[model samples]
Target: VEPYAALVLGPALLLALLGPRWWDRLLARRGKEHWDSYEALAADYLEALQGMPTLRATGAVGRVRERLERRSAALHRTTVAKLRVSLVDTGLTDLAVQGGTAAAVLVACSSAATGRTAATGTYLLLLLASECFRPVRDLSREWHAGYLGVSAADGITGLRTAEAAVPDRGTVAADWASAPEIRFEDVRFTHPGSGRPALDGVSFTAAAGRTTAVVGPSGAGKSTLLSLLLRQRDPDRGSLTVAGTATAAYTLASLRRGIAVVSQDTYLFHATIAENLRIARPAATDEQLRAAARTAGIDQEIARLPDGYATLVGERGATLSGGQRQRLALARALLADAPVLILDEATSAVDERGQARIVRELAAAGRGRTCVVVAHRLDAVRHADHIVVLDAGRVAATGDHTTLLAGGGVYASLVAAGRTAQEERAA
Candidate 1:
């Protein structure tokens, strides 16, 4: 009786163990497919949310929704496939348990019929068989329940590992008070997933206590050069030095603290006007804030607002006009009082008159500081002490504005185009 029971249990256990292994293989493939679909859907959803205004304006919201629905339907199909596999897996486990129990009962009945064991022994065999299969049944159920959770855990782990690669803080020491002369020597940088380099062996010098303008056409790597100087990214095959020290040698906080930037797209938190200004200097007084705003030429406008400095800017400063937002960003950078000032398309939102006024204000604010101005509008940067023209990630020419214009190279071509655009706008 024992030998017959052993044979039945052995086969049942093997089937139970191997069945889930096969199911797990199927589940793994399904999970990977599901994850791919989920990721694509999430990316599309995020893009739509971020570009909702554009989609609405272009009347493409319906198209985007249709695409999302198609993605969702595909995801549903994959999920249903996984569920089917789970159901099949459960059925296999049930078959193993039921078969083992039936076999054990037959063995017990035969023992009693042949008088090989007492009735008590038969009952004990039934009880023992139930105990043997109990753990296996529970394991199978738990594995089925945890499959989704395990896949989700893998996603979380991947996110953490990616974030861990970028350090929030640095161990290097630095000094922010010293106005550094920025230098990029034979710098080369290629953005992720791009074949061409953003900066190709680019070399230049931006002197301390002077304005150096970076002028170029679109995708000429002007922004990339600034990003490297600010240490947002390190150059792939060159050195970037500030005040004669490698940019990477400074802590992220220290490096950022040494430079202030105002760009065309000013990001303002959904907070009070004063709160937004305070992001530059958290301990600045209201009087100090007013002074900085005055220098940026936005103080009068802010004063006229219903809530004045207490007014909420709404999401990304959408409550204010484009020019107003740019001025506010300029004021914030001024309040920062860093040794270096960067104005990347800072006057892009303003009119010609406004652009000239902001230029004057910036010239005043940037006195005795290293100023890096990145712009496509040549007129705005014509008075720069030095102008660097970039073309296809290389410095096509470098000199003061007058010299570059005289050279009749890439800089001249860009300036001529800018003038044509300005004239067309006037007409």
Candidate 2:
């Protein structure tokens, strides 16, 4: 056989070397887009599911279902296209492997017929030719398996990239045993793509072992202020400190561990009551859970349930009443035992008596910890040790209830409006 017959394997060797580069150009770009498309579709499905009740109320469920079907069909088409691209690459690889082996076999036969080698030599040549393509086949198989990971890795990176831009790292630890003063010094923040700053020149201190209430008009930046304190956001122009130490000095995990939050929208998964409470403190005992629930004014209600702590909350606590969900959130926060507690409209859904009990519980807890509140009702904050009134993203006034009421500014007007509303309701 001619030594030049070995030249037949040239194409296969070239493909083995260059195929990866080709795949990277086509497959990687498609992979990222594929993940993004799937994510968008999934988000739409979740939205549709969550709003199903509203859709039914408006007699729009069928229309929404039709839209979803259209999207599903589009997704099916996209999936088929991606599969075809993968198959094409695989087919090319198989073609090279087969063509090279066949050429080598034909040459070996020609050499044997010419008696250029004994039978043993021809058999050896055939065996050697088959094994030569094995490595390329192995690489092709590995590539097919690994392309799935490439697409999945993009989705994982996207989920994490939001907070990755700002690396919050520190070695300083928070003191869990003592309540720390949380002070915002001329803090300012503008949300991405927003035309106006959410909080501008806003400064206040939530003193240790005291209840501090933030009362504001609609859009007065109350929630944004608390988010800064929670270190969910970093202020653009100023510093926030806890216990005289800048919040950035403490590790993110430790800073968060020292604080607990109960937002207006309570989130409970589909699980037993006991399981949800344990999420706040995984090691909490049954007695501890009961105590926190009692303080949040929900223990008696649980006692009435047939399964008590074993009751399921359903999806996002949909099975329970709004008041019940809020109380459960409060109980979970209390169970966390953090030295600093943040409550945003914590009592808005509770009955009058339940609200009073929650207020009293906060007061009692204030002796050993700090409480920062974004109060829904102005009158509910009458007993707050300190009140910070915000207007137009700035501190309009700051004082205790009586002083601010007597001072006759924004806080006083808010109080008056609340009282007048109450009087109107009574009349």
Candidate 3:
């Protein structure tokens, strides 16, 4: 009915048709760059900060700083590009709205000049034209302001829809009456994109209330085997059982609650010594902390610190020696007082004398509990009640120190190599 109003509607309809497509393509394209660069920068920052001590010790801070600078530059470039796209799209949207308004005025002016409409009607048409453009203009401004929300929506949706790789299915937690035995039956796992399986049909039993030590060559999947037991990744082929119950049947929280792990690279955040120890057993008494630390053979060293138990160990315990850090981790695990404890080269950095003492301590402290240990240093495993020797992701030998030493197989060779290395270091 109002033909002149159609003039104001044309550019808006055209913008409505084309603007969204442009934003989707240009905004998303630049947004992805922003995301990628941000991820890269975050990874670089984490690596640099965590390895800061090593970089400084090796005099490679400048090298790491250069890499960080490059990552930052890439992120900056992505940010500037994204800003430019937003600005251009916003300017184009404003131009379309203005163009539609100007067209409406021109059409109304023609109607009045040709003596087809009164001044009052022409004024009314112009006012309606501006009002019509108001909604479209407000939409453009809001789009520019809220584009971040649109860009982040995909990431949010993906997280909400994501499925766990290994679903947690149990409603009831596994209840063990005693220190549970750990058993892996025909277990196998291949890391994604790797043809070689990390663990192949690996089977072993960490008997209840006994120490079971896993020893292996460098690439024998010792760590991979431990990862499976911790449920860091579940087996692709077989079952892991605790106390004769399949791990898959137990709630992850319950299963993990029953086991404690201390690895060579055990982490300790920047916190007080007692604070770190308390992480394992928050309700642990001070005496309990001291007893555990003493059993780990680190109590003397800790006592010597200026602040004693209140001392703040720097990032990853950088303030302490490697052996001290390992001992501290051992104390934390002991504090957890779980049914099972794992030491994956946990005491490798300690002096052999201290290692021997800690081993004996674990043997004593482990009296009603089970301990699983993985150590390249045979001293830590030599006295273990049961030892599983791994080679190429399979058990090559299984026995105690005497039987395995008598076998004169891979286990024997490892012992010989270790003795030679010790001799070399001594000489």
In terms of lDDT, model 3 sits at 0.86
Model 2: per-residue Cα lDDT over 134-206, one tens digit each: 8888987887778778888866777977555335886799865688888989999998899999999988888
Taking the candidates one at a time, how many backbone clashes does each contain?
A: 0, 0, 0
After superposition, the stretches of candidate 1 with alpha carbons farther than 4 Å from their true spots are: 1-21, 93-145, 153-155, 162-172, 190-197, 236-238
Q: Which of 2 and 3 is the better model by TM-score?
A: 2
Question: What does candidate 3's lDDT look like per residue over 332-389, in tens digits?
Answer: 9999998888888988899888888888899999988888989999988988899999
> What's each prediction's TM-score?
0.78, 0.87, 0.83
lDDT of 1 by residue, 149-241 (tens): 776777788887775322545566656565679898999999989999999999999998899999888999989898887777778998888
For candidate 2, the 10 contiguous residues with the lowest summed lDDT are: 1-10
The lDDT of each candidate is 0.86, 0.85, 0.86
Better of 1 and 3 by TM-score: 3
TM-score of 2: 0.87
Q: What is the C-alpha RMSD of each candidate to the true structure, in Å?
A: 4.5, 3.1, 3.9
